[model samples]
Target: MQPRLNFYKASQEAYNAVKNLENYVQGCGLEPRHIHLIKLRASIINHCAYCIDMHVKESRHDGLSEQWINLMSAWEESPIYDDKERALLTWVDAVTRVADTHVPDSAYETLKAHFTEEDMVKITVAIGVINIWNRLCVGFRAMHPIDQPAKAA
Candidate 1:
């Protein structure tokens, strides 16, 4: 699909603000894998193919297992995730769909079992950042780069 516009070039200051948030989220002490999972799952829910493709590549580069990546959309039924991971995923769903879920107490209670107050804030920030990115990418029709076959040596 053709892009609606080059968001970055169209508004450098705005893009830079988003980049700043990205930097903060990266340093917020959440595990790298958790960050990737949150980003990927939220992108899937938001139906942002560009963000989904980007996060999948990043996650793979960080050595996340293919099985885990494959299970992101149906994480509840996957055996690959632990209790903490499950809780985080649950939280992501609640917050990402906050308009509908209203981030119910049950979701908060489950998250509290696995994360401290500070960690909860960090996770929420991570979720918020990803949601913002998903909206921008999808709205702008950002396209993920097409994969090319490896060249013979």
Candidate 2:
């Protein structure tokens, strides 16, 4: 489905403002892979096929193996991810589906064990941003074709 508007093109200033957060998050010591994971999790929670397809493509560019990427939906049962990655995934799920799960103390403590305060803040911000983007894409019914590649960030 076509979007009601080309949000990126129609509002360059607003788009830049959001894009600028990427730079800020980068400064907070978040890895590119973690950022993509956050995006993928949020996309999955929001059921945004456009964002999922987009982030999956981006993740592949950053060297994420197809197995790991595909296993993200079943991360709990997958052996590919480590405890830190598992913790981050847990946080992503809680935050992305906040209304359903709420941000639990266990998840917070788990995340805190793996991430510094700065990293935690950055991760949360990353999660928040992706959730926002997911909502926008889902609400607008953004569509992606199977053969098309994601546009670069």
Per-model CA lDDT versus the true structure: 0.95, 0.86
The best candidate in terms of lDDT: 1
- In model 2, which runs have C-alpha deviations exceeding 4 angstroms? 148-153
Taking all chains together, each candidate's TM-score versus the true structure is 0.95, 0.87
Q: Which candidate is the best by TM-score?
A: 1
Candidate 2 is scored at a TM of 0.87
Q: What tens digits encode model 2's per-residue C-alpha lDDT throughout 1-153? A: 567776787778877887788667766678888888888877887889999999999999989999989988888999899888999999999988888898999999999999999889889999987876777678767787678677899
Candidate 1 to native Cα RMSD, angstroms: 1.7
lDDT score for residue 93 of model 2: 95
